[model samples]
Target: MIEYFKSDARLLSPLYEFEPGCWVNLVRPTSEEITHVLATTGVEEDFLRAALDPEESSRVELEEDQTLLIVDIPTLEESNVEQDESKIFGTLPMGIIVLPNTVITVCLQDTTVLRGIAQNKVRDIHTAMRTRFVLQILLRVAGLFLRNLRMIERDFTKIERRLYDSLKNEELIQLLGLSKSLVYFSASLKGNEVTMEKMLRGRILKLYEDDRDLLEDALIEIRQAIEMAGIYSSILAGTMDAYASVVSNNLNIIMKVLTVITIIMTIPNIIFGFYGMNITGNDLPFAYWWWVPVVISIGGCIGAWIYMKRKDLL
Candidate 1:
């Protein structure tokens, strides 16, 4: 759907139709809507469709009077199955197109970055000031990254606690999912940082003093988020490796105990087998006594247990 929003007295107000100096927000627009936006806004078709592709990397492009800036935005996907993980974090591309007449944003999904502006959560928003408006959006995106990264950290802690209590596949799988989320956040944040750096140069988009400061703030947040992603990723990877080693060691210990028991239990089998043979009791007085083998087996088991205990294998 496409919506028109223009800042009136520094507050966002909805418009029924397109207007100059207004913001055009597109969220999963249809083919007809895309065509209409292109014809009405005079934005390049490529710029309109740039962010629709999920694989699109963050970058800035220039086409005469128009500037297309693509950045990665954090997203969360929730699972409904009871056995599956509930939250999975990822990223998607959001396109910010600055035209001579209007500013446009296109994305395949609605994002909190846009919602904050639309909801008047951001201060000093002006759709007519295209450069400043774009900076505000970038700042919001950076904030969203930090927000999601913190949540991921919290999730890591929760899963880590569960894992410490019991070594279960469910908890380990959740940790793996959290690790993957950090990886995605890291890559996306780096891509966005590069794109923001290009804008910081004041080459692709014009930047006034205030606009430059705003962009710098966005960059700082992005850099901090990048650092956090890196740190979290490293810690999670190491934790997973350590857990794997622990599991392997535990399995080895269990198998050793089972093997020792099997060996000790074989003593009774051997003694009973000899007595079951034909004419086996003729040469021995106690050979016919069933209690003799039973006593011997019990003594043998005790000795084996003592040996194993001394070796620290039991």
Candidate 2:
């Protein structure tokens, strides 16, 4: 869908049709809509497609009539994946195109950043100030990354607690998924940082003092998020390794105890087995007693228990 918005006294209002000096927001536009936007706005189809691609990286491009800025935005995919195969999330690309007459944004899915802006959540917003408006959007994207990163970390913490009580494949799977998510966050955040640096260096977008400050703030947030992702990934790796070792050691201890018990129990059987064997000339006076075997077995058990205790194998 294509949404048109115009500035009205520093606030945004929807427009029925395209007009000069307005913003055009496209969310998973249909083929006809894409053709119409391309035909009417003179934006190259490839430019929009690049941003719509899920695998697109963050970058800035310059054309004859427009400038294209592609950035990775954080997105969550909800699914009923089995506990073992759960996943955290990934990213989608968003295109921000600045034209001579209007600003155009294209993305495969709707994002909260656009909705927030439309709802007047951003202070001092105006479509006529295209550069500032784009910067504000960039700031919001960076902020969104941070927000989602925090949630990921929280999930990791919860799983970590559960793992401490008991290690399970399900918990490990969750940690793995979270680790993968951090990787995506780190990559996307770095890509966005690069794009912002290019914008700052190329001077493609005019910035006032406030715009520069906002851009810098966005960069700071991105950097912080990158650092967090790296740190969390490392910590989780170490934790998983440690838990695996713990599990192995625990199994070994249980097996050792069982082996010791089996050895101790076999001693009485060995004694009885020897006693029961017939040698024609050998007989003890107590051997005729019916309780003799019982006495021997009891004695054998006591001896084995004492020996095991002394050997510290109990």
Candidate 3:
């Protein structure tokens, strides 16, 4: 999808056609739309297509009059099923191309970072301030990372609570998913930090006083996010290991109980086999000779149960 907007009175209003100082927002643009954007914006084809590649790294590229800033943005993927706990977090490279006449953003999917700007949810967004606009986007990207990190932390807490009396794999699986997300967030945040630092150096993109402050704010958030991701990842790793040990210990307890039960049960069988042996003359004082073995077997079984219980092996 392709849409054009220009800020009017601190709000992004729709535009019928490309205009100077307008924002071109593209989400999974088709080939024809790409061609039209390239023809109209005169941005290099490589710059337009750089973000379309999922594996693209965060970096800044300058060619003559145009600057391409690729940054990793946070994204959430939720499961389709109602009961599926498959909320996975990831990062995608978003392209921000700043030109003298226009500013363009390209990404494979519409993200909250851009959506907030487009919907006027963000404050002080002006398309005409091309450099500041890019900074705002970066700032929002960092904020989104922090927001998602908090969500992950909340989820870890919830799962940890559930894990106390639960022995299900589903919760552990979800923890693993969250752990994987932390890994992704950590790597992406670090990459974005490097890219932002380069921008901060004033070599790739020019920065005004206000824009420099904004970028610094973004860097601070990104750095905080990196630290948060690392902490969460460590906590999650330890939690998983502790739960794994608990599971193994539970299994051992079950096996020990089963072994004790089996040993106790064999007493009756052995007694019956010995009493039923083919003996021509079996002398017993009781009128019912079979009662002797039955009583003995019951006594032996009780004795074994008491022994195991005292040993704390039951």
The alpha-carbon lDDT assigned to residue 9 of candidate 1 equals 96
Q: Which stretches of candidate 1 lie over 4 Å from their true place?
A: 80-86
Model 3: weakest 10-residue lDDT segment is: 279-288
Q: Which residue pairs in candidate 3 collide?
A: none
Per-residue error at 220 for model 3, in Å? 0.5
After TM-score superposition, what is the CA distance of residue 140 in candidate 2 from its true location, in Å? 0.8
Model 1, position 46: C-alpha lDDT score? 93
What C-alpha lDDT, on a 0 to 100 scale, does residue 259 get in candidate 1?
A: 98
lDDT of 3: 0.90
lDDT of 1 at 41: 90
The lDDT for every candidate, in the order shown, is 0.90, 0.85, 0.90
Candidate 2 colliding pairs: none
Q: Residue-wise lDDT of candidate 1 within 1-314, one digit each (tens)?
A: 99999999989999999999999999999999999998899999999998999999999999999999999999997643357643679899999999998999999998888987899998889999999999999999999999999988887887787776699888787887888788899999999999999999999988999999999999999999999999999999998998899899989989998999899999888877777777756766597577988898899889989988998878
TM-score of each: 0.96, 0.91, 0.95
Task: Write candidate 2's Cα lDDT for 1-314 as tens digits.
Answer: 99999989989999998988899999999989999998888888888788877888899988886899999998887634474334477899999999989999999988998889988898898898888889999999988988888888788778888786777777877877787788888888889989999887647787788888888988898898889888888998998898898889888989988998888778778767766778542564466566777778788878878988898876
Model with the higher lDDT, candidate 2 or 3 = 3
Clashing pairs in 1: none
